[model samples]
Target: MEKLRVSDACIGCGLCVAQNEKYFEFNDEGFSKVKQEDVEENDKEELLNIVESCPAQAITIEEEK
Candidate 1:
């Protein structure tokens, strides 16, 4: 399975959320946060787009062991 993470580098630009609200959302501090849920295999492509769109390079997708 794949996991999504938002790093401390996030600048709260809200671009990720704007791209896909189903996977990303804003936290109380206004930074982007990955929704806690299993990332389906089909969602990888879209997730990658979101990851690439992050100007701060804060989003990451990793394979689980």
Candidate 2:
């Protein structure tokens, strides 16, 4: 399975959150965060696009072992 992650490098630009509220949100410090790690099959493509559009390059997709 693949998991979504928001790294510490996030700049709190709100791009990901704005693109998709289902999996992305703001943290206490105002940085971007992944609301859930598991990515649904139907949402993968949209999430991938959001990841690529992230200016901070903080969002990523990782393979789980």
Candidate 3:
């Protein structure tokens, strides 16, 4: 399985939140945070695209055994 994460490198640009509200959202500090950690198998491709498109390069996907 794959898990989603948002790093401290996030610049609070809101790009990830804007891209997918289901997976990302703004925290109290206004930085982007992972709304959900578990990534669905069917949503992998789309989520990967969103991860790559993040202007702050803060999003990451970790493969779990």
lDDT of 2 by residue, 1-65 (tens): 79999999998999899988899989899998889889999999999999899998888999986
lDDT for 15 (candidate 3)? 82
The weakest ten consecutive residues by lDDT in model 3 span 56-65
Task: Give candidate 2 misplaced runs (Cα > 4 Å).
Answer: none
Over 4 Å off in model 1, which ranges? none
Which residue pairs does candidate 1 place in steric collision?
Answer: none
lDDT score for residue 61 of model 2: 92
Model 3 TM-score on a 0 to 1 scale: 0.92
Residue lDDT tens for model 1, 14-56: 9999988888889999998888546788888998888888899
| Order by TM-score, highest first | 2, 3, 1
The pairs that clash in candidate 3 are: none
Candidate 2 achieves a global lDDT of 0.91
lDDT-wise, the better of 1 and 2 is: 2
What are the models' TM-scores? 0.90, 0.94, 0.92
- Candidate 2 versus truth, CA RMSD in Å, comes to 0.7
